[model samples]
Target: MSRPRDLYDDYTPSQQMTDAIKAWEDIVEQEKEVRRAAREAIAAELRDARVERDGVEHRVSQEAVARYVPWSEATVLGIAREYKVPGVRQAKKKAADAG
Candidate 1:
């Protein structure tokens, strides 16, 4: 076994190790930023897609009801969904109510 060196005076890292550590840290931070950005972008895209799909589905139901005379939401469940809407978040209370 080798003798223990004085870490306070004799311990010195190679330049390569220092540089490698710095580069590794920079890369890790960059990757984290990219992942954060991608997650936000995906969330926005999903919200838009949901709104688009909801609009189409609502139109289909509206058309189906139009076939009848004096038709109104009162004749059905009347729970219409909103379209192209943003800045809306579902409450946790709704989950409890649903269950």
Candidate 2:
């Protein structure tokens, strides 16, 4: 394999090299700032979209829960009765024993 060339082998004058390097560094710094700004803008848009989606999901869940409130309440009451709470009255003896 051919050996890799040394970077400074054909070196230009120090002053010329320093000026060129400074110009390139300035360009790179500006590009980095532009990229950072673009990333922030994208992140803000994503956060707004997520908030909108969450609002829609919350509304849907609330509607569904309202539609089934009576059934849900009945199921909960039945479970409480089976577990012998005083209000349900299905297992008075068990409730008294626990008390």
Candidate 3:
């Protein structure tokens, strides 16, 4: 069986060869630009996806902790005390409550 002739073998004249080469170069340049743009767009989309995933993971972790941990005001106060930070105080009842 005979192998198929390459496209480069089809061009005969020097001018035709030069034109073909120029056309091929133009095509290659355009393709490179297109590929670069596509890669940049994909990278941006991936970054956005990562940020969204991080936000979702943070919310899920908070929800999981809230579900699993029995946190109370006293517990918060105790933590604050351990950290040597001021904690929340209870509001005093108004005199109207004595009526």
- Model 1 is weakest, by summed lDDT over 10 consecutive residues, at 76-85
Report the candidate with higher lDDT, 2 versus 3: 3
Q: Tens-digit lDDT track for model 1 on 1-99?
A: 999976687678999999999999999999999866654543344344332342442123333333442435432222223323243344345555775
Candidate order (lDDT): 3, 1, 2
Model 1: how far is 50 from its true place, Å?
5.0
- What TM-score goes with each of the models? 0.45, 0.35, 0.38
Worst 10 residues of 3 by lDDT: 57-66
Residue pairs with backbone atoms closer than 3 Å in model 2 (clashes): none
Sorted on TM-score, highest at the top, how do the candidates line up?
A: 1, 3, 2
Per-residue CA lDDT of candidate 3, range 2-84, in tens?
99967886656789889999999999999999866654443333233222342442112222222333454454344334445
Candidate lDDT (C-alpha), each: 0.49, 0.48, 0.49
Tell how far residue 41 is off in model 2, in angstroms. 0.5
Clashes of each: 0, 0, 0
